[model samples]
Target chain A: MHALIQGIILGVLTAGVYALMASGQTLIFGIMKVVNLAQGAMVILGAYLSYQLFTSFGIDPLLAIPITTVAMFILGVAVQLLFLRPLKAEDRSELSLLVTFAVALLLEGIMSVTWKTSVRSINTGYANSSWTVFGYQITLVRLWAFLLSIAALLVLYLLLNRTRFGRAIRATVQNPESARLLGVESSRVSALGFGLGAATAAAAGSVYGLLYPFNSGSHYDLISRLLSIVLLGGLGSIGGAVVGALIVSTSSAVVASAISPSWSEMTFFVILLLVLLIRPQGLFGTTARGAI
Target chain B: MQLHNRLRTTSSLVAGLAAIALVITGCASKGGGGGSTAATSGANGSPLIIGASVSLTGDFSDSGKAVQRGYQLWADTVNAKGGILGRKVQIKIVDDASSPTQVVTNYQNLINKDHVDLTFGPFSTLLTIPASQVAKRYGYAFLAPAGGGPDVFKQNLTNFFFVQPAPTTQSGDVFANWILSLSPADRPKTAAYAELDDPFSAPIAENIRTKFEAAGIQTVYKQVYPSETQDLSPVMAAIAAKHPDVIIGGTQSVDAYAQIKALVQLKYSPKFMFQSNGANSPLEYPNKVGAGNTTGVMSSADWFPGSKASGSDAFTADYTKKFGGTAQQVDDNSAEAYATGQLIEAVAAKTGKLDNATIISSLHSGSWPTVLGDLSWGANGAPTGEFNLVQWQGGKLLPVYPSGVSQAAPVFPKPNWGG
Candidate 1:
């Protein structure tokens, strides 16, 4: 029972970061029809940046988030403007897969060359520190990461719902032709949307460095999991992403703690299989989804 | 129309002629120059190239990176001393990424393309299994620095050599003897009740079972979990329900870490929890799992910096100076990798030849000083060395067995245990 409770707490804490990362993926998909497969690589790049800042400049990872996010945001804008913007609308969806995959490869190459493909973990003094509530141990870093993820997601929600730029993005997602008729710049929205997606990755990346050890190629695994979450969350829905992350992380943790550790990894895929069986469109997913 | 057709026909004919010439040249080169070049590359003059395929990027990256560092340091030191056998040596390294498919491909490239005389490793048993076949097929001297799972070395590959002791042959024996040393009444009844599995842990688990059964201890439960398992809770809970007096962790570090962490969280403290080589590298097991939690957990070790073994003090001093930290059992890995170079050097000095066959023959018969003391290989290519048991006490690993090597007494009557 204690293990179960602890597993739930761990799952909940981990979900926040997963939700943030998935939100970016979904956001990009909403405004653009591209899948943006490079989202995972961008997350890994953010992690490396945080690691570099912590190691080289003695900056705390949490403190380095603003820098990493802004830097990645700029990178995302450049990528969309240069590589993603010029494709014909008809070809955008199919071509974006190859383009984003290329971007992932490019980031991986730069990271490998700079860091030499070594797995690194940030060992803060509080790495092992945790708080026990109701017989559950919650890692301090994980708790903070969870709170930070929620805060970031809330900010993202407000930005999309309460601002003019948010209106434009939503308008474009609902009807691109209508959005263009209203004089909303679809191209500018795409560049900013990509930047926003990359921004969330930076936030999640900072917390990721705190929770796990990573290297250049870790993005491969991260990307696979992120894709699973995004698909399970219904492709372009931010709210669906949060729900999907909870289900995936909670089930895996619960299985690991209650059923068998060996079966934990399989549980996620199994759940995904079951979900796809019943709800092919995903829990909150719609057929009329925007580009990645 | 006639002019256009004629132009197309001439271009096609030119392309066909060029293709034919290229194929002829390729066949000629393969039949003659390829053989000559390969012969010259392997002949008396080319620099000896050694290759290693290791996980430089994933979970086992720490161990792989350290081994690489040690390998590099040894190579650099040797080259600085005028090279091995007076011929310059080059080490070709590839990242196996901890995957078997990548390992096989990398192994082939290293052997066939890089033309390394001897190869060191793609660390982890998963990668080692497929990679071993590459060595067997090509007859390259494969000196594996790590990856001590039983199946990896259980093959008929005479070209393969292990730098570490087999898991079952080491940990299984240690745990069984320790169990026997306990009073019969104190010994838990269900041999079947305690289960352990890790691809690397299996040998030790099997060894433990064999030793217990041989000693006439009846085991009531047994199961083997594949290495890919990310959870061990169901097994642990089942064993706890059976109320076994001890739970042996046929565990590597990650498995051990996960198992112990789970055990503490689940609050299913066994009478004892014993770990395998995977628990050897990290010196902070007690701290990681909490001091009292791992107090009575027993495991065999190849080296303990705290031990009073012969030359251990000198090793600690020199290694500490060189690495900027105290040498833990994990250093045994780097030491073995370094010793591979030294052994090669010793053999090359004797034969005065850098060929694979000559070096292998010499290596089988050679005995040399190593960080672990005098080192020699058996006909089976496994190390002809003994290991000792150690228990974690107050955040330190204390050698507990083989009276001569022990530095501190095993802290029996652990802080919070059934005993």
Candidate 2:
């Protein structure tokens, strides 16, 4: 029972970060109908950006998010406009995979050259400070990261539901032809949506740096986990991504704590397989595009 | 319209799967560099081109770059001192991106297409195992820096030599034997082991676990995790629950940093902790795992800038001069590579020959001196060497084992994390 409770606490703490990371990938898929495979690389890039800020100027990583998000947002827009915008509609889905992968490779190369491929971590004074509540330890950095993830997810909800741009993005997702006819500039909405998605990477990335050591090649492991979470929840559904993250993280933690750590690595794929087998569209995922 | 919609949905799933598979592949070389010019004769002849495949862009890129620097530094030193046999040395390096198959292809291209006069080993035992096969097929002498795992020698290739001080399988014994040698009060009562499931990390960790058991230290817990494991929080949580007196981790720099962070978060500190990789490197440890947290953590290593081994001090001074870093920051990987170069130079000079067959035959018999210290290979190319156990003290990795190399006594009941 002690191990079980600790696992739940660790799981819940971890789920928030996974949800924040997956939400961005789902958002891009929802709005642009393009799978941004480079989302993981973007997150790592954001972490490096925050690392530079903290190390160079002594700015806190959490405080550096606004700057990194703005920077990543701009880069995302440039990428959409320069590389992704010109693909013909008939081939957009297939071509974007290669294009985003190319972007990932390019980002990886730039990061490797810039950072020298050595693993780095962002160490704040409070990175390892934890609270022991009910005889179980909870690291302060994880709690702050969890709360930040929740706050970022809330901001994402408001941005998608309450804003005029949110409505435009939703309209474009529902029916591109109809949205364009309804005076929504689909391409502009697509570019902004992609930027918005990348902005989430910046938000989660700062927390990620505090939690884990990372390098340019760290994205290879990340992309797999992100894809698993996104796939389990149903692609293009942000809510589904959250649920998927919660289930996967919790199950993996529980298995590691109670069952076996060796089995925990398989826990993600097992749950993903079971969920995909039962509900191909995923829980909360709609057959059509209205869920955005 | 309905079929097209289904096709789109199906494509999304396929794309996700394919994207995951493709990125995980980590293939795609950064171009096979160097013009396809076949290397020429030696012994005061044209430049002797040595071709090697390194993980310049992918998972092992950091170590690959270090190896590259080591090779480059050796070439610079050798050329400045008048090239071996008075023949100018040229190195042709290509990126394997850390893929095993890609390593094989790189060696093929190096040997068959470029026809370089010599072949050096790639970064890890994983890559070296396959790359060694290609060298064996071509009968080229393969001297590698980091491929010291047990499996590499299992290939029974007479041409290959692992240049490190010891193979990874024997790496843990120095630390484990040291723990056993301590007084009963200082010795750990229980030890827990966790290792990455790679060929390099697992054997070293498992070997330590066996030593602890044989020495009567109770085994508390053991686990082997896939190298690609993303979240280590659960593993750490599980381990802390056990509360073993000593923690032995078989991890490289990234995983090593992650394991320490996880344990710190869990607020569990072992009395003695020995890491097979990360804690030994001053350059990698303090930056990733906070400087204060590194104190008392022990690790095994083949070489350091401080070692009194032949060519050691000169390599450190030259490296600092060339790379603009302090002597303390020159890593074991670069030192290992330079030693490999030293081995090559010694054998070539001794034999007065540059042919692969002659080099292979000479390597099996004679003792060669390198920055790592004296090394000799068995008939199967396994090194007759052992690594020094080092501990992080006062923000430096100081040798603490084997009185011959001891700079300080090993600290038992290691200071807790963040102390």
Residue A275, candidate 2: how far off, in angstroms? Answer: 2.5
**Docking outcome class, model 2:** acceptable
Q: Model 2: clashing residue pairs?
A: none
lDDT of 2 by residue, A1-292 (tens): 7667888898888889889999999989888778888999999999999999999999999999899999999998999998899998788989999999999999999998899776788999998788999789988888888899999999999988899988898888888899999999999998998898889988888888988888899988788888889888888898988998898888888887777777886877887888889988776676777566
TM-score of each: 0.71, 0.82
Candidate 2 recovers a fraction of native contacts equal to 0.66
Q: Candidate 1 chain A vs. true chain A: TM-score?
A: 0.97
- Note the clash tally of each candidate: 21, 0
